[model samples]
Target chain A: MSRPPYEPPAQSLTGQIVDALLVLAMVVVTLYLPLLLKLSGAGVTKAVQAAPTWESLGQNAVMAAQWEKLGFDPAKAAEIIGSRFDYSFSWGALALTALVIVGYFVVMLRWSDREYRDVIAERFGDDRPPRRR
Target chain B: MTDITPQNLAGVAAPAAEPVARRVALKRVLGPAHVWGLGVGIVLVGEFMGWNFAVGKGGAIAALTACWLAGILYTCVAMIDSEITSTVAAAGGQYAQAKHIIGPLAAFNVGLYLVMAYTMLEVSNAIVTGDLIEAFTHNMGLVGEVDKRAFMVLTIVFLAWLNYRGVLATLTLNLVITAIAFAAIVTLFLYVRPWAPGETLKHGDLLTGLPYGGLGILAAMHFGLWFYLGIEGTTQAAEEVRSPARALPLGTLTGVMTLLIAATITWYVGTGLMPWEYLGQAVTPLYDAARLTGSAPLEVFLFFGTLFATIASANGCINDASRAWFAMGRDRYMPVWFGAVHPRYHTPFRSIVFFVPIAILFAVSTPLDQTITLSILSGLLGYTLMALSVVIFRRKWPLGTIDRGYVHPLHPLPAILLLALCAVTYVAVFLGYGSQLLAMMAFFIVASLWFALHRYKYVRRGDQFTMRWPKPNGY
Candidate 1:
């Protein structure tokens, strides 16, 4: 059973608006998301100890207890597992990040396509009514 | 609309009087979406595994840089390949394209090399995925571990069955698997939002060391290529695509772009969470980072992502390898039974069936890194030929003379650059592989011997398949 030849439906105003918004969202995500993630100081970093002694660091009994369970000197453990951060962002990192974001969006758009359905329907040559969204 | 009649297909092998009749046929059910899915899905394992090996070779920074370099190189190949696929639109991917464009011997070599490459890749994926499943099960505290070899065989059989069902089922499964795997990456990216505030960036300096310097960077080249390694496989679906001219370029480029993003994020996030040395040695580095986060849910998410990615990649490889086998068989370069398609499923079922035991044998025997190198070796040979084919075909057809949908932009430059890059990478692969290079050489010799035997058989029969290719006018 052969179906009607595919006729690409007219783009509704809402559909067109959604498409425009998707494009806009993609642009924003690609250009700014990397900088935002970078500025947020969320990356691998070296340890920094604020406390002068194990007692000072382990004022909280829970912290002292946890360090003891791991079988390390409280002072040494404090230094080893201290508050860590990385705020540095290089130009190269930023460029790579942006490239990734853009690539993600491009792939996403292609992966979720109606054209595959159209092609399959045509090849199967079915006469079923148009699928309801 | 493009014609589906066998008479219109320039090089499809069948009896001369009944060119359209065959034991089985491919159903043309793919469009741009499915094409993109196949392109990205087949190669997604690179994102999930293997790439971190580059970190050991050249440190994180240099490895990342190498990836970008390879990305640009593949972008060129993808564009030129898209143009050729659209114009030729044959079933055997690069093999079919090369058959008409570069002649029969070249086609045989290209097709055989591609089959080897995809089979190696699929075998590697099966083994790795089996190990991953066991590890993930342990991580999740699931009971009773299965033997890795048994699991590997099961993975190959399952994916082969999916492919044997038909093209639509295979592509549909690919789309789902790729989507889930990609979603997991997105989840990781969102999780790794803020840079840690106080830790020293020791790895930044690690990038400059390059371990053994130039040799180390060269050693890292194949792992870098992993980022965008199998995007060219998209062309294998040309016979099934509704409009290869329109879909090939859109799908291939889009797929390449998607991989670029996945590779960059996977690298940045994985390295950012842990030191390069630690990340490089771990079996699944990304999942290791999730564990470091100490978030159980995040760990589970990344684990599922790894699992799905492996499935998608292996499944796609099975589809690609079988098609190459089918093409070779149809051309009578191999046993005719391998060319038989299923009557109802419209698939190259016999080829799929034949491929399984061989893939299982490979998966059970080879170690992971060696399997990876073998795949890369065959891939480099195919890539070299494909880039060369771009130049030869362009010169022979000269754009206007042929009915083509996509014309490569900045014609000849991409082809030239691809040739040079592939030459450099080939040297890099050779320098890196040491003893494994000898094994690859041995494999090449074996392939050559097989080709010689095949040629002899064809000559003796006097009903040579190679002689029948109708020469295009003005070439």
Candidate 2:
């Protein structure tokens, strides 16, 4: 029946988080795609295996054999990725994330504003407050 | 007797019988997206780090199949958690939710179960990380062998330092780890000409006279349960999340689904590429697979990815587990001082300070397999209780909770079924390691004692709460 003595307010961040996710998405796409697919056809997987140190290692001796057949060359892949359409996707993704984050905060701002009606009514106005869920 | 009361005489209808007399504002932290990432990042990484080879290369077929099945059950658990959490949304994860619906003793036991379960997880992650570091170093011909205990201590110390910065810091670190883990998994899927499930199974299960025998499937599933341990972290953080009415469900579902798919594919492909015989024999299967599949650099990347994942697991656990103390301390269920948060960082400083050091000690002093076995067993105990809570709380309807999210369509059936699976795994654990009986029994005794002591404290505090609540006798 008794309310606890006090409850602390939840922590809020000054900087929005959704934007960070968007940036990560852009970064991963840029960095990951090239690493994954090699143009001369040796992908990042192959490149890692072919280096002399890896080729000479145990079991890697055989792994290197498979890497070559996969048609991966890291150098060529890098060139292709560098030449690819300048990060239109990154720009758009960030824009979209910004829009969504801003919209979410705006909605929450309005909801909290409704709660303040109680404070407003208790002190001055005749506004009836909304019932709590 | 009319539908009007003194307050409602002015044409205002009497308020419908309020289910709960107490109304509290649930805390708001991050949105569902970040919360989901934190929960998923916590469990997904360490399991991803360790199990990749077990499922991906060696027992790809069996391991992936186990993960898929486990993933389904995991989703069911998450859905059930979502339903319960939408209503409870308290700080204590499974412990509080179950306690309110069941009773203090039950909640206390749930907390105890989780403490052990998560502790096991910490040890397992440390051990796996130690193994990886050892393998990397040995292969590089740097050291003949790495001591597990030394590394465990290192891991604990490192994680403690990270967590000391507080929850926000851990959450940020978790995000980074989650992203890297996903990227690494996606890269594997994209680059590797992944093998078909059936083929991979046939190829990976190279261990003759294995795959389907007396409890091998059950044995592996028991361990594989690690991948799904912290799904409830989202639910526990329900009150803290922004708009938990929505975030709670979204975080639970998204986090589970994301981890499930990646885990499944990684398991399947890793298994298919490597001969199961070779995989079973190797020290750390996934790392071996990475080296075998690509080059030294990819192998190196796999190492880094796993390291990040383990760090994140420890980091996230430190963040979430510490909150238990904050809740307990704040409410006087435990010592009051533990409720103290760091002034500058706004974190559960003491709990964070406490968690990693003990975990690190276990990792360093205990044997790897022993630590792992304990971790999975303890986690299963918590999970089993949560699944059971779904059934119990739903049956007890008058506790004043409203669920505003999607309930699992099958309702009670999924939770019940999951409990059955949990039972099977529970028995399997006993079979896998009979020595674990001593550990399990010891933990049970300790829990019972703690439960009695906590109830004693509750009564002594004149807390205004009575025993036998939600039941026939009201103390």
Give a tens-digit lDDT track for model 2, residues B1-475.
Answer: 1121112211212232212223222235568777877788777764455453223211335555567667877877788877766655566667656545554455555665555556556666777778878878876678466775577678877877776765555676788777886776676665565545432233323323333343445545655665677777776565456566578788778888788777766665555555443443234555665666646777777778777777777766666666764555544444445556676666667666655655755566555445555666566666666676676666655223333344556777888878877766654444334335334544444444543543224322212121112221111
- What docking tier does model 2 reach? incorrect
Q: Give the TM-score of candidate 1.
A: 0.73
In order of appearance, the predictions have TM-scores of 0.73, 0.68
* All candidates: DockQ: 0.01, 0.01
CA error at residue A80 for candidate 2, angstroms = 45
Candidate 2 Cα deviation (angstroms), residue B276: 3.1
Which segments of candidate 2 are over 4 A away from where they belong?
A1-133, B1-27, B46-61, B141-150, B195-214, B281-283, B398-406, B453-455, B458-475
For candidate 1, write residues B16-55 as lDDT tens digits: 2222223235777898999889989988888878788677
Off by over 4 Å in 1: A1-133, B1-7, B10-24, B194-208, B459-475
Interface RMSD values for all candidates: 22.7, 22.7
